[model samples]
Target: MNRSADIMILDLSESSAYKTNLKHIDFCGSPVINKDHWLYWGSRVLSTSEASTSNVLMRVAEQTEFLDDETFETIAGCSKSENYSQRCSRTSLQSRDKLMYIQKEQLGLESEFPQHLLPDGKFNVDGFILACDVSKETVLHSNHVINIAKSIAKTKKPIVIAFTKCDEMSEECKRHYMTLFLATKELKHVLCNLPPVETSAVKNVNVEYLFGSLAMLCLRSQKLVKKPPLAYHEASLFVEQRNLHVKCCFSTLLSQAVPLCVYPKKFLSWKQVLADIDRHPDLMNFVEVFGSRVAFEMYERYVSEAKELWAMNRLRSHVPRLFEVFQVFLGVVDLADMEWNMARDYMRCHPLFSVLFENNDYDLGMWSPSTFNVDEKSRLPAEILLLPEAGNVFEQFRVGRSDGVVAIVNGK
Candidate 1:
């Protein structure tokens, strides 16, 4: 599959979409995404590539076991005129963290599957769908969501706004919310002439236009990178670099265990301090999941020289699992399947990786202003002594706080 052709539907659960992703996916050619479990009450689904969608979601809505027959009649009547079910049939969907990916070019890409964050800390997809619950308050709250969309657009990625649950709205309510949402600062600037597609997974309202427009937008976005394929060695490196990045967060209280040696250990050496850090209760948690070797790579290493082995490396920032993940993602002449997914699945399955695709930038107390400034009184004090002494007034004066003498990091 052309992984790059996958489009992300950012699952901003906190953005007031009010848990509409599953329903939307159910409506968008993915009712049977996971054969193990049905998302809701969909009996059969209309494939995105199909020509007619009249009875597609209408059938699902009609089969909604919880609904009254009269209600089903009310909903089925609204599905007659989306004018284009083929657009939606041309796509597929999956949700991971704050991201839900849809396949455009890879139209048959698995509807529901796990996704990994490429070692460069980027999702291996193109385009985006920013979904919002169709409510007045959610419409207003979506302004923040649009700012995120703006950033995605600035990166030259295609993005679209999906006002989900319009089936629950009145015509006037839809218009009011659209007017309010479209007038948002970032919305006007980023979307420009593009209008949002109001969708109703229940009624199958405009479902085709939403994803169809996105597929075309994503296709158009790829025109800029339509150059010839990379050379053999370059392709090898691209596959090697597609490894997923892992970050382990800590949530336990280490209030009793000290984290800062800013006061200096009488016997502290640079490597010794790092070794102590490697054994830190919070950090050692990573050793449990990723092992001691991973712990060494995360805490004991200086800079990685291998990072530049591939051209245009995507990971712009460092994460705890960089070295191990480097075993991947080089582009190739032929898109043969690699064993990358096995490793990726293992990495993502870790309990500490709950926020794997969350957009939050975590601080494990690894950075301080001291690294940037030479002066002692900066935000983070430089460790002037190779081994700190408790009696050293200089070290005491330069003390800077970190996670806590005992603290949890990332979500471990």
Candidate 2:
């Protein structure tokens, strides 16, 4: 089965018109699965005593012994116009609030088996269509809505909130719903990311756009894996010898070529790099000039070379678990420090070059403003390094600052 074609509609609103809405929201002849656990009042319930106190909830509470068993089933029963209207009278604001509370309280009590019941083994759910009637009073604030949303939070699937019965709403009511929908982002965590779309199966209002949007979302959701980083050993290296034209950021106060003069000599590995970056008065500033990726590559090369040196000295066992520790740091480190953490993530993208060090891959030439005949005291070139390759238009460039910059130049 085409997993991409599979779309699941979660009737968490427990709308009696669920079947009608599902039938109306066409998936371009693709199979649509209906889950009845929410609609039918069965045996696997929250609390019969609490449910018994409210006649409305009690009827909903008595759905079926097994949630999979559909005594008041929608798929087979919702066949006619009258069937669409034959629903519980709990669509009011107060009733919805109570229902939400019950749903939230009974979260783990019932079986989640219905959720896994896909159309077939070959297919996976592409998106969740949350069907809620706009004619109803309550909306995103209701507990059931939050509960259903939270249930699928871990799935990382895109949620499309379809406001049904739009034809029955006035322009003012539609605006109100839209207002509420947009306001949901402020509800925190759950609905912040979901987009609410107005749809009406009866009038065919946004039915086409509804499914079309889903297809588009499904398409966009399939992210391509990023291409691996260029390996230092594999990359073309240009050592400064003859006069070379290059663009760089320069500060005259330092009176030195930024990349060559600035060095975190005391730090040797990822651990020392991260630990001392914030405190080292000159390291971060130097990193800022050469660009983060180049700095990261530099440190990465340092750690790799250090490891090789240790192994050569017959101290392989003494090498700290930098790779493993760096991986952990990559996953947890804040984005604020992400520029400096590139080495930690290199293993995933460039596994082969993730180890060892090579001297020929880089130029060890010292650059000074005096070479350019600049009389400015402590002048530092912002574009500290440039590696130009033969034939290939793309050349790697680095610029350093707290906010780092790296670029591939396609031409001169």
Candidate 3:
């Protein structure tokens, strides 16, 4: 019984069709390569000598389960016809098996499995790579690839993303490939940052890296020695980093929370606020800020305000949180005053004011020279009024003014 023969490689490349056929020649009792371009097998060693045509060695000892010959024949025929130039020669067996064996062994799957199944009769292979043809663009095909990859990854194995047609992809196709590559990298990062084993894939980019990682994981699982838990400090560090990431996301949302001024009186209703926030390009960021119950409460309150309440509420909510975290304005007495002034300034400069006050009876003549010029002494009023030291001067001015005023006493 050869435990090392547990792993196998299923190559779906045009070059591997003949070699894949040689699985029928002997009872290797290991895994067999399948038409799906997946290596449905397990391995025992972290690394094995490269398989060779002259020295064909069995890597695993378990009986391989394969579909019937008819299926195999159909697949083989398709490979030959579809990929004529790269088709594997069907002439020889010894050579073919050796090639197949070598190709399968190269993936390195020793780290995936435990010494054996976990008392439960489950089949585990250190991880398997489910390679697929990039030429196929159908949603069904991609789904099939994903399903197969998922099934293999579920066996506590890391999957290697592999693809064909690397040499034939167009520039645009290559760009798409790079996009997928970055997406895959992001997926891996997300998985690693998470509790582990949350995501896996079998695609073209990083396939080899995935294979090597899977091998290491399988080997670790086999050792059955529980790794020591992280120290408190280390755990704390991880938590801090995670928090930093969340804060960064919130900052992004805050940056994008500029006033849209679409509603009348610049007053965005709660529904409008929700709709606008929901349209944010980075929805995750919005969710981080406005997704919580507290944030939603603030959002509702701000939306009900008369003018651009959403922006005002967002600023207010964020300012407190920011101060709490960074302690920026702890001793600052006029923080709220400064914040309200800033909001007022922003509203005053906003272009929406032209539209918001278009229907109102109150005139903005004070701000315009055409209506009331500063150089005209006739417009000046007597008893120069001062706002009694407490309330806002602007509010008093708005309330106290009539159409025009005249000087009271004789002046020099």
Candidate 4:
């Protein structure tokens, strides 16, 4: 919403959602390339007659569209063919535009804009200003904008909804806005419980605040980028300042310091790691050789024997067995694309670790030379370790790390 913002308005001429916004809504005259669907849209600014309000232009596209007779016949022939998929593929290869239209129904075309046109690292917009007219005609379109905004940014950009033509809204229209905001509160990019700024250039009401919010958002985003990372003590102090329980934050930090046993460099596989641990009943060597490599990597940095033993003990207590540690490491590698600070916290608080530690009646205590238990040794292999179940449980853990970080920071 900045005064100097470089805005790009796309004229989605073929879109059903945008059809009403056009001066002359004529879809029946346009030719259809395919029976599946046909939408002819281009990038253009809204005409003065089309734009009823001064708010910035935004668009929401729908997959559904109409097709002409010849195109419909071609598609129908392709469908009826014995090699339907093959024919479809050939058609796509022949005409890229046709393929694009066909793919729109199954996979959203907007996804291509983010993935291809705006590849990661190339473009970084400060924020997105979603301008919508608050009326029955745009009710569904507004929701679509919210959804598409989230899809485009994916938590990268802060979204500020500017409800245009607010001065023209009725009491019923006002109620609708409230209902819509409440319904979309769970969406990621949209600020939770925060109502859209009721704006009107015609009335000159809340227009300044709408733009000011954009500037403030840009400043906040910049501050986050320039801010230095907090040290351990500083982070603890930060948690305390936020009214989080100091003791819990300290405990969580301490959990990270507690050294786990060092794991081997090259793993033979999960089966091999388990088999080796079974063959060599020595807990110290078992842990030192087959524990978490991530833990082992941390262990190498610590000079004190007490800290090392504490770490080793923690590894034994929380992630004792070879297979469990292996699985945890797999989860670690799987989410390597995530930020380190976020990923580590997830590794600490994720419930999968709790299940790994708490489920089995076995607790491999601190490593010692003279300890040998035949009964526990016999029971180890027979005790079922559901690897697939653990994977399924933590499947969402990486994606939900933001929530996990909030919980940890709040001492929850």
TM per prediction? 0.28, 0.28, 0.24, 0.26
Cα RMSD for predicted model 2: 25.5
TM-score, model 4 to reference: 0.26
The list of candidate 2 runs beyond 4 A from truth reads 1-3, 12-123, 137-141, 170-195, 221-412
lDDT of 1 by residue, 209-273 (tens): 56555554555532322232333234334433431222334212121122332221222334664
How do the residues 41-91 of candidate 2 rate in per-residue lDDT, one tens digit apiece? Answer: 221111212222221111112111111133333443222222222222112
> Which lDDT tens digits does candidate 4 get at residues 146-220?
445444345354556666665565556556655665566444335441346666655445654555445445444
lDDT (CA) per prediction: 0.36, 0.35, 0.33, 0.36
Ordered by lDDT, highest first, the candidates read 4, 1, 2, 3
What shift in Å separates residue 234 of candidate 2 from its native position after superposition? Answer: 57
Which ten residues in a row are the worst by lDDT in model 2?
Answer: 57-66
Task: Write down the lDDT that model 3 would get.
Answer: 0.33
Give the alpha carbon lDDT tens digit for every residue of 115-151 in model 3: 2221122233443433334443333323322333334
Question: Which sequence of candidate numbers ranks them by TM-score, best first?
Answer: 1, 2, 4, 3
* Segments of candidate 3 deviating more than 4 angstroms: 1-124, 135-140, 169-211, 221-412
Higher-ranked by TM-score: 2 or 3: 2
